[model samples]
Target: MSDGHPFRGNWVARMYERVRKCGYDSLTAFAEARPTASLEELADELGPDDIAAVQVFSGLVAEAERSGKVTRLVRGQLVRELAENLPDGWPAVLDDEVRFAVAEALGFWSAYTPETHKERVKQARAALRATPPPPGWRPLGPDDELLLTLLPDEEV
Candidate 1:
């Protein structure tokens, strides 16, 4: 990924391009389709950079879901694909936003233990507290909402 922006760069850009080329009109459309075979095919093509794009895309989808831009069904399906299909440590490589998103998704889907989900959410909050959001960033998205639910009232 590029240092200039969280969403730009070769792999992230290509991921979007591939989505369109794969016959999906948008990420939401792809999520709705839940084309497992196509997703697996894309996963096979992923290098390190492409994996990073998946992480970022995961975060973006989470934010959209929280904002009601994405429906619950679509969000669940997309996150499930990401969590199940990606390599191990994929969440670890991401920033707080992506980590928090993945945690929320996993918890919602019951894909991991309650304890494990709590730990992941805790780690994500700590990371958020340590690093401020980038310029032009907004607050109260999915990450903030999840953190509020996980953290003590005073902390929120």
Candidate 2:
């Protein structure tokens, strides 16, 4: 998987294609269509690679949010799905880069205001911290600087 990316494999690619083939133009659309679908159901449909599905979903969500294709409501739904579905010891399956990407996306989406956004960031960090990487795996910390840079002075 691209030397080190845990999510850049045939399975994840196939999952993306399957989402496209399901009459959805993008992953965001697929997520929007099944707002109530559990993550377990999605993972089951994608194959046995639930970890890869999570990674791919996170990446897709990040891309959609960055592109302005995902609205606040949809973003919230996706984030909630992530929080609810990820399995125990899930962090062990992810590499530092993937973790950083996820943190970046969460941080970006969580930026709402000085007060509320700060609380969101705190919660995101706590969640990430709770899942430590596997033994000997060097975990990357969240990119707070990037989040700060992306967040505007005034809330949008």
Leading candidate by lDDT: 2
lDDT of 2: 0.47
RMSD of 2: 12.5
lDDT of each: 0.43, 0.47
lDDT of 1: 0.43
lDDT of model 2 at position 45: 53
Which residue pairs clash within candidate 2?
none
User: After superposition on all CA atoms, what RMSD does each candidate show versus the true structure?
Assistant: 14.1, 12.5
Give lDDT tens digits, candidate 1, residues 1-156. Answer: 445433456655666666677686565565445433223333434333344534434644554545544334332333344445442323435577766655564444343223323454455446644663343332222233433443323211
Flag regions of model 2 displaced more than 4 Å: 1-8, 48-51, 69-75, 78-118, 121-156
> Would you list the clashing residue pairs of candidate 1?
none
Task: Compute each candidate's TM-score over C-alphas.
Answer: 0.34, 0.40
Off by over 4 Å in 1: 1-8, 35-49, 52-67, 70-156
